[model samples]
Target: MAHQFSLAYLTVQGCPPPEQIEIAARTGYDFVSLRPIYMGLPGEPNYALAENKELLRQTRKALADTGIKLLDIELARIHDGVDVKKYLPAMEVAAELGGRHVLSSIWTSDRALYTEKFAELCDLAKPLGLTVELEFVPIASVRTLAGALDVLRSVNRENAGLMIDAHHFHRAQDKPEELDAVPRTWFHFVHLCDAPAQIPTDREEMTRILREARLYCGEGGIDIAAIVSRIPAVPFSIELPNLARVKELGYEGHARRCLETAKAYLAAHPRPQAICCA
Candidate 1:
């Protein structure tokens, strides 16, 4: 496999959906994560592809022409005043775009309610052939690999899995050995990046560090190799959001460097056998 990496939208969140696909292809990435939903938060980019027929057509065309696959679609948050029903349109579009995963987060502290609501979303995504990845962040209720695993087992939906990021993994003090307790099928994909060995104490600070200051695959102190060795054979998303570096090299250059560095790492430390690009 010559190309087996995905360019995460957050890596270059400054770019539009269509351009993300084009840049991914130009930078030698195998897949691109699509953002077609309003994050329901201020300052986040929103693409109304669900209703924009022409825009959706263009995005689809970009993917088809570039041969860069649609790895996932995102920000289906299970938070206050957010209805799971609203994800239906994006889910429909994502399935049409050949996306297999829905990136989501859990905001409520109510474990039972979160489980039921998450399972409901999974039910909606089931027939559409899209799985729900409940991303665990240090700022959220599902904060650890163990917490995420608990939620997955509680929901127990076939189309539901855990989405782990190395930054959060270390923030929660989760060890690579902890991967043993997680079922192999419980992972749909993994978010890959590295960060400083020193962690911040403030929640907002931690959040900013994760979204704005992530280092490349091996540039930081996090053991990306050990963490990756545990994730099941699956397509990995390069989600380095180094804003300063982006300002220095631009999106295309940053993406190319990230891909090259990641490919070298993967070559040296190959994942478990049977892994294939998505």
Candidate 2:
């Protein structure tokens, strides 16, 4: 069977969940990811779908009308001053909208504490039939596959797994072949995008690179075909959040380009190297 692809929330950050669902379906994506929680700086748009009943109703209707599934709801952070329990309302809303996973990250310096919080979040999600995927970013505390695996091992939550981002993996200087050592079940899905081989040495610059600039699959330096081949069989979320390009092409056009480029890459690579994992 072919892998199901998603139109990630970042690809059209300004769109509300309902609009995103419609765009995803029109662009031929099998699933769509939502960003109900605000992760960026203030002054940005946040749909806050959990608190908006009417919006959720509209989003659910969009899903039903389009037959597009909800891939995940982002994002929960394991940092200070933010209560994980506060995410429950949003999680509940996402669940109601047919979301099956939640994207999360840890930023604090404290590892053990964050692991506990992640496990607790998993506990809360189990009843809702949702899994928590910890995505590793260059600026995030869990910055590499090794770091992400360590936290997953520490938490030991069946509902928690690591979400590999191709940009982050390349920036971390990790080889795709290294995924052979990773447990297959640890990966529920992955964020697929490409970037230049010249990675930023500064964390702030790296953050900017991830948030504002990313290339569509097969467009930049990342060996996306090799990376996807080495990783376990899982769906790919097209997370190319190129803000400038969105301004040039508009939301629907940009989304169509993303889906088209991803499909082109996949079609080019008909066979993938098998990964051995237990």
Model 1, TM vs. native: 0.94
Residue pairs with colliding backbones in model 1 are: none
Per residue, candidate 2 scores C-alpha lDDT tens digits across 1-278 of 67788999988888888888899998889999998887666667867787777887898899999999998989898886567998998899878878889999888878778888889999999899999999877887778888888888888889998888889889989888788787888788989888888998887878887987899888888888877887676788989999988999999999999888888988998644555676
Candidate RMSDs in Å, in order, are: 2.7, 1.4
Clashes of each: 0, 0
Instruction: Quickly count the clashes in candidate 1.
Output: 0
Cα lDDT tens digits, model 1, 1-278, are 44367899889976887899999999888899877887755687668689889889999999999999998988888876557999999999999999999998888888877888898999999999999998888988778877778878888898897887878888888898778677788776788888888888998889898888888877778887778777776788888888988999999999998888888777777666543221
Candidate 1 residue runs with Cα over 4 Å from true position: 1-3, 272-278
- Number of the top TM-score candidate: 2
Candidate 2: residue 181 lDDT (0-100) = 82
Assess the local accuracy of residue 88 in candidate 1 as a C-alpha lDDT between 0 and 100.
Answer: 94
